[model samples]
Target: MFVHFDRPVPGWEPADGIRTLVFLANLAAQETTGDTASSTSTERLVHRLVGSTVHDVLALALIDDLPVPPGSKLSDLGYPLVPATGDDDTELVDDAEGFLLLGLPLQEDTGVVEVEFILDAGYLPIPGEVLEAEGKHVIHRLLAEAERVARVIGRNTLQTWLLHSPDEPAGTGEFADLLREYGYLPGLTEIQGFVDIQSNIATTAIGESLPQDASLRAEIIRDLCVPEALIPGLIELYRLASVEVPHGSLDAEPVEWTPRRLHQAAKRVVTTERSMLSVLLIDDSGVIGLSEVTCHPGSDPDVLEQGITIIHPRARGRGLGLLLKRELLHAVATELPAARRIYTSCASVNSAMIAVNEALGWRVLSGGSGWQKHLPTV
Candidate 1:
């Protein structure tokens, strides 16, 4: 006699009817995944937990259903009731089955909400037959609700996320087929990784930076800190670098970059204090290279996720990419010392970047698909 319903964030009704889609991870999958006991995942779970967007929330519970935190709102995720920290949270965790989250950057363009889901490889054959009836079929419900919400928001696409880890968990292939069957597109494949930013490997590499005469300065973008006058420089930057970014497929259309898009992106970063965008400028050229590492919305304060790193073609071959990274690493230590781990991902096809990551002590954690750097705070 199980019935399912979504609880709206209190005091936050969707005037546009784009109420959040609540998806529950059944940690106690009595009928599915054979993970009825209780399982915590670092792969899929960490990425979702790494960085947070302006509008996000991740509520965890021990029950079969998702827990919606009290006083939750679309504008903010109420003070996170962190696990393993205080006695007050014991009651909160004990009350629910698992967690529910409203995650990262909604499509400002289309109003789509995005989320990633994964299961441990050790768990085979996600018991679709047994739980489909218990909770309206978890995966199917997510897709249907996503679609329903997308339609209400007046958009046709529900650009939610679906990641494929290298481990190729037992049921992943089947799950993806089901996703594609449900109208989801295979948009992009990303590698998840981490590295020790303070390790001997990275310190040695940073030491190789060109002497002080190099005349390159790195600045992390903050609250409209990048004057409008400098926007064009970043625009020119996109024109030269975006073509190289890995995309949907080898034959995919070239990304159409625009100055307005660059400005819009820079403006969005200002909304969050934790987001970091490090730009390198040479004395002669306006904007030569840049790197962006955004801390996840509800991510551990000690970590930030890689966003973008690009060096203009004219500035390449001189190790500017390495320089940009080295200097940005300095920014992390001095400016964001409390931050401990830095994770960046790239496509398997990007060998050059992969090589650079290897040199910087970044190891691929997700079956050799992405790189992660562990930044030692001390």
Candidate 2:
């Protein structure tokens, strides 16, 4: 008797229902594998993102597994059913069938779709198996909603989609097999709860200057500043970064960043209240390497996540990635002394970067390939 919608219902107070579903999905790891440590962290980060960020939320019945309230219609949840095979005589807000599908945008202009089909979990009862006809029905429902919303928002939609599942045996085993058949592969693994440890700045070699390669130098950007002078460098930096995947591989849509895209990205970050820092490597020409870190500062100390840190293939012989990371860490330590924990995710195949992070005293989670740096004190 769970209800799913495109947006929070009329009287839902900041919707604990959405939070509950996220918790349930993540709790699967603890239940199946008994890994309380990572499960706790994943859940915490998910709830934190929903609370601090302006993310779109759907699926409101996870609150307590209750039925849709009486006299409440699908339209009340921000989803209006469109008239199918009609001559324009019907309102799209008609009653829905038994199952409910939900969606929200991952980014405003980016065509990524975040989908949650509660039935897929089988906490209640799904007609068939997880990805049988019933599960596919829910997926198609979400896709339709994604297409409709894309048209209204005037953004290219659904070139990408996120299908979140608990890190349980079922998810990694049979359930994942079904998703792969549908062209939805696991893209991220959540590395959850960790103890914050004090950074040992005394032995840290952060301030060591990079080689004075007459051609290359480094700079850190704060407050979303893209100096008119460095715009070209910034563009190049993003172009190089978007290409290099976790291992020695190229991204599907590699080389997608343009100067226009850069500005659009900066505009969003500038308008938002979060903190972002970028470390750029520049030669006499333009940006050849880049690393970034971001965090949402709150009343107490906050955690920071390292963003993309990539070196152009042409510029990789000189350990530029390591240099930039050290510089980025130094910047974070100095600029955000109040930061509690810093973490970053990398592909399991990327051993080079993992080694560098390991040397920095970052703790690595076993199940997932992510490293976390804790700041027990400012």
Candidate 3:
């Protein structure tokens, strides 16, 4: 039997936290080999792998408490473990043979919630063998719980659920077939992009200089104070640019942004050492182009994750998106020279951004599609 903890990270006991960290660490070890898997210097690897979850939990908690921000509700389910009690203590017994981590998004009625699931490397059977029954059972239970959450947060019944995996395996792969067996239908595709900063610095020099248009200006916003007047423009730009990009499914909506939501996002950090950086192209009208990235100095200082890069519709044709992106790259290189790689995700249909990424020497690491299922009316 599996024990579930619905509480936030701060609520979890030390033992519970340790169990989850060890499970994640082992999972990483399984996925890696050679020097990475070697126990000789695994402390850093474990910190990086397990630290990610901790950061996410803290970031989620940093959002405002009432009227939860859109796309901020995340319910996590850890691997199954037997619960045990001692004379003076309580702890989880991790003698179990399988592991799974599921993160489910609880959205509004008629909205889509994304499902993120991971399994122990061993549980993945080769071509013909049946999928592990234990992992399958855990997934079902998690989905049921997700449905209950959606019902509570939503109107009456949950509407649509989404899952994403590599596009190549969606139709014919074993894992894809398994998801299909349940109720998921393949939907929009996404492209994963990666760039090695050190290698591309020379090629992306245009970013070395700011936008040249006399009417336009650029600035990098970090932990500095945000101007009061520009907040509304930033919110509007987000709404316009984000909606224009394809989300999970055709019906999926971009996150609703409010002034409060914007402030919360700007100030939130996963860890104390984590830094949120945004490169913005502004005009007398307001922010017209933007690029964002985050770095985790405490856990893994060498990797940077790209957030969003958008150019206003009116400002489109001037290569501002590329300008913002390259400028952001240079900013990161200057501020965090230790950063080695930068990662980004773009909807498969966004060829313009994809072309810009290609121009900066970013390469496609993987391709995945969002799959959705519309639940039956209750």
Which candidate gets the maximum TM-score versus the true structure?
A: 3
Window of ten residues with lowest summed lDDT in model 1: 14-23
Runs of candidate 3 with Cα error greater than 4 angstroms are: 6-93, 96-112, 126-171, 203-211, 223-225, 248-251, 270-273, 296-299
User: Model 2 Cα displacement at 352 (Å)?
Assistant: 3.0
Model 3 earns a TM-score of 0.71
lDDT of 1 by residue, 1-378 (tens): 111122333333221111111213333222232321122222223333334332332323223344545653332222333332212322333333222343434323324344333222222244332223323345555445444444544444344443333465422555555666665555556555665556633444433464565666666664325666667776666565556787553122233456656555556554333456455555467778767666533446566676677887777787777667776676676666766667777776677777777767875554211111111222
Candidate that beats the other on TM-score, 2 or 3, i.e. the better one = 3
State the lDDT of candidate 2 residue by residue for 1-378, as single tens digits.
233333322222333333344455545444433433323332232233332232444332322233444444454435332211112222212222222223344433234334443332544223233445654555455445544444554444233322222243223544455455554534444332322324544445554657856776777788558778888767776766655564221113454566676776676564434578888888876777788877643312455767777887767777777777777777777778776556565554667776666666656443432111111221
How far is 38's C-alpha from truth in model 1 (Å)?
A: 20
Pairs with steric clashes in candidate 2:
41-192, 41-193, 42-192
Cα lDDT computed for each candidate against the true fold: 0.47, 0.49, 0.53
lDDT of 3 at 157: 25
| Runs of candidate 2 exceeding 4 Å displacement | 1-13, 22-73, 76-112, 116-200, 204-206, 212-216, 246-252, 297-300, 366-378
* Model 1 backbone overlap count: 26
Preferred candidate (lDDT higher): 1 or 3: 3
**Ordered list by lDDT, greatest first:** 3, 2, 1
Better of 1 and 3 by TM-score: 3
